[model samples]
Target: MRLDKFLKISRIIKRRTVAKDFAEGERVMVNGRIAKPSTDVKKGDILTLRIGDRETVFEILDIKDNVKAAEAKNLYRIIE
Candidate 1:
């Protein structure tokens, strides 16, 4: 799945456009490298997103085209 789509489907960023813009702004990273919205997302990949002074990291656990709200979080695992 696409990085942007995964972000939205995972409810990480809430919207695909926002996720794309975040990537364009270099606020999202995959495996510690800047990643574009079109970047392919695969299981076990690490994603880092910067939000001001805060940072969030997640490990890709699964990929799904569509998931229920209750199951969205299962797509990724938060990393400490």
Candidate 2:
């Protein structure tokens, strides 16, 4: 799945446009490298999102086109 779509479908960013903007602005990274909105995302890939000064890292566990609110968190595993 596209990185932007994955973020929205996974409910990580809430909206696809916001996710695209984040990716375009270089606020999102995949496997430790800056990624664009069209970047491909797959299982086991590490993703890091910068929100202000804080960084949120996660490992992609699965990819789904649509997910229920209750199941959204299953798409990725948070890294501490």
Candidate 3:
């Protein structure tokens, strides 16, 4: 899945456009390197998101196109 799509589907960023903005601003990283919204993401990949002074890390556990709100967290495991 694309980074932006995953962010939305997993309910991490709430909106795909917001996720794209975050990536365009260079606030999103994958596997230690900065990533773009179109960047491909898959199981086991590490994602780091920085917003202001806060940072969150997650490990991709699964990918799904459509997921229930309550089940979104299952798509990624928070690492921080």
Model 2, span 1-80: residue lDDT tens: 99999999999999999999999999999999999999999999999999999999999999989799999999999994
Residue range 1-80, candidate 3, lDDT tens digits = 89999999999999999999999999999999999999999999999999899999999999999999999999999899
Task: List per-candidate RMSD values in Å.
Answer: 0.6, 0.5, 0.5
Runs in model 1 lying further than 4 Å from the true structure: none
Clashes of each: 0, 0, 0
Pairs with backbone N, CA or C atoms under 3 Å apart (clashes), candidate 1: none
lDDT of each: 0.95, 0.96, 0.97
Error of 2 at 12 (Å): 0.5
Worst 10 residues of 3 by lDDT: 71-80
* lDDT string, candidate 1, 1-80, tens digits: 89999999999989899999999999999999999999998999999999897899999999999899999999999995
- Of 1 and 3, the candidate ranking higher by lDDT: 3
Off by over 4 Å in 2: none
Worst 10 residues of 1 by lDDT: 71-80
- Tell how far residue 63 is off in model 2, in angstroms: 0.7
